[model samples]
Target: MTADNALPDCVALRIGLAARALPDTTPAELVRVLIAVLGQPLTEAKLNTLKVKDLKTGANGALSEIDDMAALRQALQCLHGEDDTAAQAAVPTPQPDAEGRLPNSIQVACASNSGERLDGHFGSCARFLIYQVSATEARLVAVRPAPATTRLSIDHSAERVKLIDDCDLLCVLSIGGPAAARVVNSGIHPFKRSQPEDVALLLGDLQTMLAGKPPPWLAKRLGRATGERPPQPSEVAS
Candidate 1:
């Protein structure tokens, strides 16, 4: 469902204000706010599929079932306070190595709706399949689930970008301009594919790239892995 359809007018207004007030708020934090406001535990899968109307319907439905308006109001106030505290807290940024080369065994994050294919868009994936790759091998590292809802705000995009901040590359079917910019700013390269591909096939291709002389980006990453200096700007340009 779209963001516009997912929430009631009042609920949407409240969330919009909170989001605007806290421009750096995380997607997980927004999910918590929705949970509090809606009075229900919404799953990431369900939230992913909801449009704005759907969100509104869900919020209205939940409110209709609740007989205690005071209780609901109190719960929302508590949640808003928690969000404020979280927004004000400092978040540590990841630093590049002394040599400024990408790591040897690079971490790559693939956007997938299911676990098997690289089909999801960068901004709206159901999950991210992470892999640790070296010149000779690739291994599955972790699977990060998407938040319950996609807010599509810059703050939400920043939060999602942070989720894979450790990674060197992001593979997805498509990515919006804003989302792509955020990913690059976080020091992750965004790779877009025209169609979904098998995860194994993609990994095999990556292994080949690593085994051979990689492109500029991968070369730099390989330099980090092997303790060699990355190519200078002039060298890369040549």
Candidate 2:
């Protein structure tokens, strides 16, 4: 986008959002850096060619303001159209009961990067996907966005844990010992998966376990007596 001519509304919107996503980057500054990298009108083609390294270039290290890689990636996503807008549309809505709770269900938080997938690592994911799961049903109750923070920091890990403090379980591709300890101390059990998978499938497995014979540790949460896999909380749809 040139200085004399105003940007198109669509382009302006995206650029404004992108600027905000990067820490300390103003629309003017982002435009300046972008112009330096891509030159002239900032079309999608030009934006696509822009790389993370390019963001760090410019006079006096102008783009050096972006120190947080997570936020930097987030800003790039805005220009790349990989942020929340498209994903949020596809995210499932909460299906809590009249009392605003999923009866006989436990809240599970999945570390997510893009959409409704358990693809992100603890303390680094873009968001925590909160799901309310019962024996026969699993519904998306909330999608909590994680604060942009430097990875592996004790302080930021606590902040992330607080985001899903209400959840019973936390699922992720991986979690570090310290972060996992924080999660456990917060009364949220951490479950690690070796690879990325649909959040639904993970909840589905939990649902099946709930529907049948759940493990002793898990059964206790449902208020079931030892050796009794009660499906009392399983309320069928009317």
Candidate 3:
């Protein structure tokens, strides 16, 4: 079979294991939850664009360790429980600090460059995407391309960094440490891993990060709608 046709089975298997382990949740629910956790919307556009390379590259390491159905089931249970505990532990308690306010809106952007010989280090050109997040939801608003000149631009990078710095939450993918460091220095933590599905997972975290509590926004959004507060900084850091 074509590798693409094989991906759904792989994705389903990964998610199903997590589901069987977390009997409280179903494989379908977990996939939906994970799609949100990874900050990916469950939509036809996304699913249509889903690539085997993306799935295998991001999940191959995890998948390789699953030797059999029993092993997979055990691993899923462990992971599901871990997720549950982590969610519960992240519940935010009330506090009085302007610092804890949830963002009203978020914008994300991506950029790539033709210069700087990024291919030498990464064996390809660098692709940069940034997400700006708020309380209700987050959006991918900007993409920065590499500079056209031989040397990189301090001014351009600085500009992009500033935009990301202003965000209450920022998600970055594929940009190297030096570029990521710019945002990290601004107090926004950067997740080094970047895959379409992984991005979806991180997006889920952004919702929880804003909610300041156990059970991320995606769960709450799916479970019910109420006045639950997102978790606090300490809760998020843990």
Candidate 4:
């Protein structure tokens, strides 16, 4: 298989593991796993362009031809099975905020195309909606347009990362492996959602997580923000 048709061993392993561990894994979740593993943007168009045989070879002899999204979903389902009830039950219940405030508020950058929803992928978003979030509330801080040139040049991914360097978290429809790594390396957290969602709803969820005992990842984010100095824009390349 050509390099482009090859799936990295790490990605294949992850897909296999996720299929087994989360037997009820949904297509959206599978896509998230794929994007996270590849560390690059993945679109339906890109996926459809890949041949089934090529994908099978790349998957280390694990997968067959997935000609379309439906086929891809079926392939993922065949790897395991789905249980919607269990999946829904797995979600944590929201808890009330102790003091309606966090030790420190965090800034999040949401990738957006229309400015109304979190509908854009990290690499292609028209702008980022910045929000300052606390345990009880989230407030809009800024709407920063994406750098025009960065999208045209892959090498400028770092420049794109710089645009949201000040944010504690980045929420997007999707993000590639390399860009996600760059974001993490810069001390920012990355989150992927399945589809376009209301920005307000996402903020509410953040608030809920803060109000409750956050997961280890989120707790670490909160802790990190307490001691770290806010990154300066000048520190990033123009």
TM-score of each: 0.54, 0.56, 0.31, 0.53
By lDDT rank, best first, the candidates go 2, 4, 1, 3
Writing each residue's lDDT as its tens digit, candidate 4 over 1-238 gives 2223434443333233323222223223444434433335543334434433443444343333333455455344433323222222221123344554445788888977564578667765557888778897676767776653212223445777899998888998777787777888887888888867888888899889988998766777776677655443222221
- The list of candidate 1 runs beyond 4 A from truth reads 1-103, 150-154, 225-238
Best by TM-score: 2
Clashes of 2: 0
- Global CA lDDT of candidate 1, please? 0.56
Off by over 4 Å in 3: 1-132, 140-149, 152-160, 173-178, 194-201, 212-238
lDDT of the candidates, in the order given: 0.56, 0.69, 0.37, 0.58
Q: Which prediction has more favorable lDDT, 1 or 2?
A: 2
TM-score of 3: 0.31
Measure candidate 4: CA RMSD: 12.6
lDDT of 1 by residue, 50-150 (tens): 33332223434432433444434433442344333422332222233354433467788887655467756665555688877776766666777654333
Model 3 residue 215 lDDT score: 40
Candidate 3 overall lDDT versus native: 0.37
